[model samples]
Target chain A: MSRSQQLYEAMILDHNKKPRNFSVMDPHTHSSHGKNPLCGDDFYVYISCNDTEIEAISFIGQGCAISKSSGSMMTEMLKGLPIQEALELKESFLEMVSTDISPEKKKSLGKLKVFEGVKDFPARVKCAALVWRALEDALGAKSGETSTE
Target chain B: MLNPNIRKQFPVLKHIENGHELVYLDNTATTHKPLRVIERMTKFYTHQNATVHRGVYGLSQSATDYCEEARKKVQTFIKAKHEEEIIFVKGTTEAINLVAESFGRFHLKKGQEILITEMEHHANIVPWQQLCIKHGCTLQVAPIKDNGELNLEAWKAGINKNTGLVAFTHVSNALGTTNPVQEMCDFAKAAGVAVLIDGAQAMSHIEVDVQALNCDFYAFSAHKMHGPTGIGVLYGKHELLKIMPPYQTGGDMIDVVTFEKTTFAVPPARFEPGTPAIAEIIGLGETIDFLTEIGLNNIFHHEHTLLNYANIKLKEIKGLRIIGEAKEKNAIVSFVLDDIHPHDAGTILDTEGIAVRVGHHCAQPLMKRLEVPATIRASFSMYNTLEEVDKLVAGIKKIQGIML
Candidate 1:
């Protein structure tokens, strides 16, 4: 497959076109806005946590296909995971896009591996990590806009 | 008619990218340097590398001569009255900041206004904003029409007794709207207001006569005009430059520094603080020679024709909405494809070796005005061909087919 094909993977395309849980979560326990200053991709992530587990996750924003799909996939992946596990996953995903991860750690990422092509394209790494950065901020003590510079 | 031979002068055009010939349409961002510019810079470093304005050595004198000669070229290029009025800075941003710091601090007072247009780049907007916040001055913005044209009537109305300065772009980087600079400057002058024109996007595509426009100050970059980066010019009137204090204090800007008292230099030396980008300035002089030899009129006509061709060709593609359809637009064409984000479109275009700019274009206020999150911009130069425009259209079609 070509570099573009690898970038716009079938699963990524499907998620972008018909995003799951792609809406605002009202009365959410945690929420934060994310912005990719380089490309002007703005997004807001919402999560409802119950006993440290994310009972619900949703996002509402406007961005490129990679960002929207990553947000959609993030919401789907973090729905039932505990807040700690979700934060760990966010760390793993950031590492995967920024640097090389071990095979065992990569396998643990599951469907998130579709973003492995992101490391090849330095410009698109921010697109894939927009929502994850928002999640990281929303999960932390601080809650505001997070910029992926 | 753009000379096809012009493409051969740019050595980068000979290379291939992504298994396809390069189609560089980001001229509005920064133009590709010609072999003349590159060779001049290389020659300067190899033969004439010396610190200017302190050394008595022959090489130092030659380097200083080259630097001063570049300033003269710039003064003639922009039709400034004196070479001392041209201050070499980092780029357009630094130029504007210098004006905002030196001129703004001297002129602006509490409750006064610095009027600007809604279509200004962040460079033209933010420095004034900083001045406003610091001095309790008001930063007023004139609105743009829906078609991306500057509302001239509104701009005139915004100029009041308390309006201290009027800053605007000669050509819109994002929308490609050429503002009525002469008329605006005349009106502002009638109001006893100073006008600063941001000529970053205008210098390459059009012939700029600062004296004719009667703007108090003008700022532009060299990289956008097929010159080397890290060099630009800020042309201020001699009378204005003589009064405003130095923007930065350092070795060169001072005439005599004593323990008890310090005296500053005059005009250009007062403005240039540190060791300048000597080689880049020499390169800029060479680029000016290259452009002047071809004639700016010929280059302007060539780019205008290419823009018209690209406008017609890109419009043929379905679901592609061309943004900023100003009546007086030049070479910039910014648009959006239906349901396909600009980043995706840019990626697809890149695969076909077509380079374009995709974002708010450092004019977020204009983006909000246009009601687009971002746009894909393909700006042309004299070296670009209509065939490259066809490739852009074809690339957009391929992106639509694959993504949508």
Candidate 2:
């Protein structure tokens, strides 16, 4: 596949076109805005956690396929998962885009592994990591606008 | 017409990587330096390096002469009447800041207004906003039409009894819309208001005559016109510079010093302080020679042809919408391809070794006026060719096929 194709895989495109959980979670417990000023990518991630588990997660914004699709896949993975496991996934997801990940770690990422191609395009790294950064902030003790500058 | 051989002067046009020749389309952001400029800068560093103005040594005298000679070139390039009107700055941003801090403090009063247009780059916008906050002044904006043209009536009306100063860009870096500078200056003159033009985009693409425009202040960067980076200029009428306070205080700008009191120097020296960017100013001197040898009118015509051709060809593509359709624009074309985001298009284009800018272009207010979150900008210069623009069109089509 071409390098462009690698970044925009069919699965990623599908997620981008019909983004899952692409909405505002009403009565949400946590919400954070993410923006990449260089690329003009802006998004808001919403999460509703009950006790120790995330009951719902959603996102809505305007951005490139890499950012929107990554947000969509993240919501799909974190829904119904324990908060600890979701945080672990976020850490691994950030790593997968930034550096080379082993096959074992790559297999653990599942559909999120599509972003491993992001390591090749340094400019687009922030695009793929925007929502993840927002999610990390939303899931943590802090909540505000996050910038992947 | 510009000689097509001008392309040979820029070495970056020959750049090849990943088995693809690079197609540079971001001239509005900055242009690549020519061989003469680079060579002259090397010569300055190698043999002519010394502190300017303060040194009594022979080498330092030669360096001061070269630097001052460059100042003369700038004064002549923009048709300023006196060399003392020219102030060496870091770049366009710093130039604007210097005026906003220095001129604003000296001239403007509380509740007085600073009027600017909707299409200004952030470099021109933020400093005034900060000035308003700092000095209890009011900031007002002139409107632009849906076609990205400045609304002349609104702009003329915007300068009223309360308006102290007006600032606008000569050629918009994002929209490619050239303002009616002389007409705008005439309006400000009729209103008895001062004006400062952001000429960063105009320095390379247009023949700028500050005297002809009759504007009080003009600011621009050297790198935008193939000079070295880290150097820029602010051209203020000498009378204003003489009255206005110094922006920074240090060695070169000082005239006298005492234990308790110190006095400053004259116009240009008063504005410029500390050690200057010596080699870059020397490079700017060579950049002026390079541009003048090719001729600004000829370069304007060559880039005009490229803009017209690219506009016609790109508009023919399906789902491509061109933005900023100003009648007086030059050297830039901004557009959106289908529903595909500009960032995605930019990345795919980079894969083909094409460099284009895709974003709000430091003109978020202009973007809001144009109703686009972002856009893909293809800016041309004298060195660019029609064939390179063809590559840009093909790259856009490829992006649509892959992305849409």
Candidate 3:
């Protein structure tokens, strides 16, 4: 019973209903479309950055609560952060949510630790990781397969 | 309500997963096997494991008999004219690809059009699309009404002179809309156009008579009808199959091998190349027996009852809306709750040991027509209980309370 928690938590649903920075990013430096063709979960991640810091980060798309909330919380987390640290954090977040990690390792996630619950839900890990995968694409860290500009 | 006696036959129905009774509502996708079907398959592998039509030994003869008997069962089940009309393929997809290539190459020309409905599963749509691309033929879609019913007038008009062939599903897997196959077949027949029906979703839920429908080709999967995977039937008219070239070549389908070229076997055998799924074919025979014993009419009535009960209950939920409310539908129900995505609802329901399919269900065009990205589908089967529908209603409420 403890393995599964309220996945559509109040926070996730609120974020879904009123997502932050959920609009087309004008004059963006990088953008990528995150799509789960299987379930029809689609989102776009946009980033504007200087040499060291991300000046702006936003997203726009339709998906389940996990996907939309991931985008909403993600834009809030990475905005105005150092580019290198943000990329590293994105990597850690993806790994933590997709696979099992110790509770001690889970603590490193801070507020995003609730998302680690997705590890218990194998099918939903993709929903939580979709925006980050797009972020990884926008960061120029990975080659985007279905990227839109 | 399902007969308890019938429910007990399916061992998986009594299964306790995550400490909750399993509520299976994704029967359209595939059904759980009964004890009889499972045992029949086991018996084939344990004793009658041998090649067909080329055996000197006694064991091989018995194996051949079972496989041949399975083919006869299929022929009788669909009411096809002869055993030669039933060609075994991997599944419905392969069955359709055979006709798209074999029949398309022989009959279709550059300007000819292949008519299909918008509600068809990808299996029925893609093969024809490939055939059209290869043959430079046009692939046309007959539109479905907002309520998921096919527009009869449009369908009638679509059978113009240029239309060489028509194909559609017996039932919409995504919407649960049972298309009037006999009436549609009549239109195609009137135009002297060839016709094919994808029966993957309909075989378990309804009684299919290919002769009555008079379709040139009918495709269905064994797994959908409590049989094993990797085996299905393509029911083609004897005259058409006899003239049509083999879809695949080599091995069992060959008459003789020579350096220059090889001759192909007659109908059924001509299309079935290489070693077939023997155990699966035999299991399909047992599945026919199982269905025959329970009767298709009984199964159809039971599922329709469940569908009605579910429809009334699901409509009571304020935000929930059933996607397809076709005047004539059975077994399956697709719905969306508030603004909640189907996947989120699926996850919540899975925790309650309820199995419901949530996706575009391989019918994206229908989703576009319905104006929904995806839907939560609860398809019923004979073994499903009334209480299970109540659990589903409760699960929908829980999703509303949590997410809305």
Candidate 4:
């Protein structure tokens, strides 16, 4: 098998078995629903936030392994970050998933760089981006707005 | 059976990927068009393309004649009672929506019910759901048997005096199960309910006779049947179409425009508003001619043979489960590997130059009932062969070997 396929399998298995932050948040300050109508992948992410930090984060819904794992990883990354920092992380994350960022810049992406492999499979990119898009929507980005870059 | 050389007609079959021959199995989504259909549309745009039904010149007359001739061909292809009963639209989705807006809005009442089967595509389900919601009616779905066949007993029990309409697909796109549309239509007729059969999946592989089936409405898209996109046909019973109100309001459908009021044209022209898909419709007519020349019965039999060959070969693999096993089915085979996700299977097959569809297939409710997230679907067209089925089996084995 190819390296891309091996990485994808590992990603999917990890997502299915030990999904990160798979729970509900109390006193949720931020919540958003994301749906991929084409594949019927739907999920909601809840983030409990204070002025300077994210107290807790959780996700609830069903999707493919790529989506679920991506959401899990995102929740872990967002916890303890300030609201502004989390928002900036979202931008860097989007840049990492979509091509056009330099290799040196991408090296700074950390664990989120696991999704760089998704660029080869265009259809699966939506799976990885679903949760991130939901986070943007929760932050007041209008519906139907897509960040293709 | 179609000639083996028929594979050469579709240019996309020769498409090479990763230094391997492309084995396309996604026909249920859309069939690759034959070069004849492409050439017909090209000739129309290049030599004789013009606006239809308005100008007095020769080119305008030719365009109008071509458009109307396509309508006549559609009427004959589906065996509609009259040429006037066939209304050209944008595709199957638009056709169903037109029926819901015009017919459902005009006739359906508060206490009435719209009966549908569980195997319907979303295009068949959503429009009626919207109509029922808008008109204060109930939408009831008939159950499917474990083998993916519609529960005829449940269908009979669902139909009552309060049932206003019955809409369903003639073939399940995901399962490939062929529903007994004629029998269902007869039952609906006995209950005084109108019947609409979504022929999007069936139109390509099977011969459709709207008059023989006695369905109130039959909808299909041209692209599914080796024709150009943006063109479809909706065949309605003349009496029902005459009674239903116009769907869209625009020029060409009106007979006279006075300051006080306007008079509309007949049934088909009333339903068809704005400039129609002229070149595409003309290409659909040529596609119909091509199918007729080759014969639809030959295509149906050829696909059945291929389906049988695929079923027998696929059953040999251990830990593989075919989703739907209806006895009366067309050329689609949806299945799941015990441990592999459908996306993984599709990716592996795609790497081997075999294209298959993997997802809910626009039937989320059915997916829920079947108790699976998704299934890998390999649908066949008339041009496919037993060798391609062998390739699919080989691909499945390769996927299993890797995953297990």
Question: TM-scores for all candidates?
Answer: 0.97, 0.98, 0.97, 0.90
Q: Which candidate, 3 or 4, would have the higher TM-score against the true structure?
A: 3
* Residue-wise C-alpha lDDT for candidate 4, range A14-122, written one tens digit per residue: 7655887887776687788888766656788887777778888888777666777889889878888877878887877777665667776676556777777776777
Q: By DockQ, who's the top model here?
A: 2
Q: Show the lowest summed lDDT stretch of 10 residues, model 1 chain B.
A: B47-56
- Candidate 2 local Cα displacement, residue B150, angstroms: 0.1
Fraction of the real A/B interface contacts present in each candidate? 0.79, 0.86, 0.79, 0.10
RMSDs, each prediction?
Answer: 1.5, 1.1, 1.8, 3.2
Which candidate do you rate higher for TM-score, 1 or 2? Answer: 2
The model with the greater lDDT, 2 or 3, is: 2
lDDT of each residue in A1-149, candidate 2, tens digit only: 77788888888888988999999888899999999877788999999998899999999999999999999999999999999988888888889898987888888888898888999999888999999899988887585789898
For model 3, name the residue pairs that clash.
none
| Predicted complex 1: DockQ | 0.78
Q: Is candidate 2 or candidate 4 better by DockQ?
A: 2
* lDDT per residue (tens digit) for residues B184-224 in model 4: 88888877889999999988688888888999999999999
Span of 10 residues, lowest total lDDT, candidate 1 chain A: A140-149
Tell how far residue A131 is off in model 2, in angstroms.
Answer: 1.4
Off by over 4 Å in 1: none
- Candidate 4 chain B has its poorest 10 consecutive residues by lDDT at B339-348
Higher-scoring candidate on lDDT, 1 or 3: 1
Encode model 3's per-residue lDDT on B27-55: one tens digit a residue. Answer: 98999888998999898888778888777
| Decreasing lDDT order of the candidates | 1, 2, 3, 4
Of the two candidates 2 and 3, the one with more favorable DockQ, higher being better, is: 2
State the lDDT at A98 in candidate 3.
76
